[model samples]
Target chain A: MNFIYDPVPWVINWLTQLLLGWGLPINLVNTLLYLVGAVLICLGAMLFTTMLIWAERKIGGRFQDRLGPNRVGPWGIFQSIADMLKIFTKEYINPVGIDKIPFNLAPILAVAAVLAIWAVIPFSETVFGANINVALLFIIAIGGLGEMAIILAGFGSNNKYALLGAFRAVAQLISYEVPMVIVLLIPVMFSGSMGLNEIVQAQKIPFIIYAPVACVIFFICSIAENGRAPFDLIEADSELVAGYNIEYSGLKFGMFFVADFLHAFTSAIVFTTIFLGGWQGPGVEQMPVLGGAYMLIKTLVVYFLMLAIRFTLPRFRIDQMMALNWKILTPLALVTLLVTALVDKSIPHEMTLVRIGALVIVNVLLWLLADRMITAYRKRNPIQVVTGKARPLARPEILPVVEKEAAQ
Target chain B: MTGMQILFLITSAVVLFSSIMSVTAKRMIHSALWFVLALLGVAVVFAMLEASFFAVVQVLVYVGAIAILIIFATMLTRRALEDKGDQFNRATLVTLVIVSIIFAGLVVSLKSWAPLQNLTSPLSAEQLNVGVLGLALTAPDGFTLPFEVTSILLLAALIGAIYVAYERKEKKK
Candidate 1:
């Protein structure tokens, strides 16, 4: 791979080494190196997003019992490329009565926010964007910018539906964001460092096992935060007519489109690293090249898992979404946090057995409690009315009649 | 200029420019964006100090969270972005003048105050290790008070935000 004139990586490596040799300190050199990594990350994210769009469509098509994108290249591998070209060459129409400045700025801000957060994400042990100790917070905080961009896009479009959709998005984003940050703190607590790489390494057992409730909350929040399906009421296409980007067409629309797909990819990566013991495959790290490959495969698998969830689940009502977070995730996260702390305290540092036992006990108790709460709450106040006469007191009414005539 | 001095000059200018824009920008959203730029410049200054963690925190907390929240607040306030009247006036000018005077006084004091010349040297690996930051946050003697207080602050912020955003509505079908 480092053979005759690859040019880019070679030149970068050479230049970096030269800087180091010229009496430049290692940290200074690393800072300069990070600039290069940032650009590469942006490029990688774009490529991955494009691929994901194709993969998701094909997978979704298969799920729906249809063939997808069979025309473009072999098995439609190049379909996304064609779509990109179409989007690029399409006419850019600035709608009448729109706020010109914010309208244009919103998409740019959205894309930039996503890309900028990658600057702190550690790709591998050696390969990193930047080793900032506050990387975890940086990722979450930068992610908040995307919500602002969405709100701006909605308002800027000057469309009523867009405005409504944007408002919905803002509320949802801000709501889920509370629990999301709290769940993220679970990792930060265990890692005892805010750096993403250090956080990954801290998971001797993936935080998912040690803190399953936090894991579930984080996953749900990530989906909600990214405006994906089941939680994607903000862009409920059937209801809001493409949501915030209703008026946007051509490149403006493309920006939102690309942002959505890229967001999913990034979310998948985050979920994998935070909860799935990032890049930690058996015997993969021993061989440098294999490690990178394994990491990519794992990431792709996670991305597919997200896609599967997105396509499978029905969209939640906005109220249902809010209720789920406030009633379920927030309380669940709090309990998990307390349980983790207590278990961590009880585990003697010397005995692995005690630690494992504590972890298991905490997990089982959490599941039992959460399951009971969900089911009991559902039973006590069901989501809907049956519109039928009341049943006999002792009759098994789990399957209630939709409609019944009175005995005449 | 040496590299460090050059970095200092660029970042200082960036900070100055953005700070001015943040105050004077006509649009509230523009003002927020300018504030983000100012915070970014502050991060660069932290980088100059070789406090990489602090640099990232400046961006994460100030640029990311604070500025975004400010933008959110601006959006929530009805018609804040539509070029409005009297964002600045005579009273604002007076306030600016007083703030500038205080800033100058502070700068003068800082210039007169002795800096840690010995500690101005580059960081060692041990000092920069990720674990060191954790120790600083959790250690009883170091920043445990601030850390606990920040957690409390976050909780308060959450409650305050929920309060501000809460609406008392007429019960209706």
Candidate 2:
């Protein structure tokens, strides 16, 4: 293999030889390499957040017709860096009457949960952390950790508002996860594997082509999962006072902030990997490193779409959000999964184009049917308009008597 | 000790410590969190044993869903936040004696188990594929009956839960 095209194996070989030359045991060397790889991925993700924050803010500003952080640096590129510096130097406040241990642990767990997801995502061929078989499940499981972090933050802070926010966040997360997991099954069913790398490899034609409904639902659910705007009831400032992280300040707050931004980008990466045929484009077969570029491009497209949605849409009401998840998205996702599975199973694998066409047609039909049902439901139960009669004005005749008495 | 054994020992320690903390923590939320840790330690043990499917499922189901439910329940129920009463109750002695007797019996039974005496070779990565597990669970001659039964049980519970939670409105005049 060309070293320029695929440097991971080459670098590993060089390191292995050097370590052996230094008389290190093989197992020890392997363990060291694993640690280095893990640390590198974590640091890389953390560092990537600087750029992500800058991009999100700049894009958000443009969407809102304003210039965001223009004075900090060129295009305000260094603004996140300045913000990071400030956060680093800020006081770490431990609120009085707080549960000390979980309070301290929550932010770290928040960041760690997001970082743990990076381990299973295959960036490119031969360039990833562990290629575990149950990567998709691992992602969901890590999401559970994120939920735990919010719970811990809320419970530990000893603030009612914080607890309320955490409760709402968890409720939103857990509710949305049902549809998310259901739609996730479509891709796994299509690819016949749960391993992300294997899924990517199996996508000769992207799974999105086969299952667009699932893709849309997955995107919506992922946004809800990340607790971004349109679904950002987690930190609805108008009500809950910054949600679960209200009591957190300084770097602890910063950690939660970083996790939020990273999670958005990570979800995009995941969407790319599963649906957009990650790292699969022309010339990728010859130059595996080119796959990384392909992956980045696809991820950016999805990430931009997410940002656009975030900046444009207003947040959902808590009841509306729950209704969407259970009444609409969950049922729709189940039908999609069922239809896709049956169709895919019945059709022969050799008839790829036919299968794709059939699945797409079915999906469009399903979407229309759901739309029609929603419209009918709305018509059947029109919003009630309560217009009570205006109360009669209470004119006081005693004011004239008081004026006459004053004159006398 | 080999690395694997050392890792196993560390995992066991974590599991034991967390389990103890889960039962002994004064605050209910802290106890729930400790229980989650103990579940995670069990997941790690599953991973160490090369049952990646089981490990991931354990984390997804036990730590993710069940533990979260427990915590939520603890939080929502009035006066469930903290235990102000004495740790040991009047029946502690009797409970301890019965627990020890059961533990001793378990130890003896486990020691006498033939499978424990002869260690089987670990499965290869191919043999341990999740597809294999799926097949085993679904195949007619395998665990199809038990799997179907479990799912049916879950569906029943779900329906029962919804029934319990549902409220009937009084008729309008």
List fnat, each candidate. Answer: 0.57, 0.69
Which segments of model 1 are wrong by more than 4 Å? A1-37, A97-99, A385-408, B2-7, B116-119, B123-173
Query: CA lDDT of A345 in candidate 2?
Result: 91
For candidate 2, the per-residue lDDT at A312 reads 96
In terms of DockQ, the best-performing candidate is: 2
Query: Taking the tens digit of each residue's C-alpha lDDT, what string does model 2 give over A1-408?
Result: 669988787898899999999999999999999999999999999999999999999999999999987878798899999999999999989998998988999999999999999999888888889898899999999999899999999999989999999989999999999999999998888788899999999987888898998999999999999999999899988998789999989999999999999999999999999999998888887888899999999999999999999999998888878988898888899898888888889999899789888999999998997898778766876756667897655345445777767766
* Candidate 2 displacement at residue B166 in angstroms: 1.1
Which segments of model 2 are wrong by more than 4 Å? Answer: A383-408, B171-173
lDDT tens readout by residue for model 1, A71-165: 89998999999999999999988988898877998899889888876676656545566667777777776776787688779878888899888
lDDT of 1 by residue, B8-105 (tens): 99999999998988888887777777787788899889878878777767766776567767876776777776766557676987898999999999
Structure candidate 1, residue pairs in collision: none
- Measured over the true interface residues after superposition, the C-alpha RMSD of each candidate is 2.9, 0.7
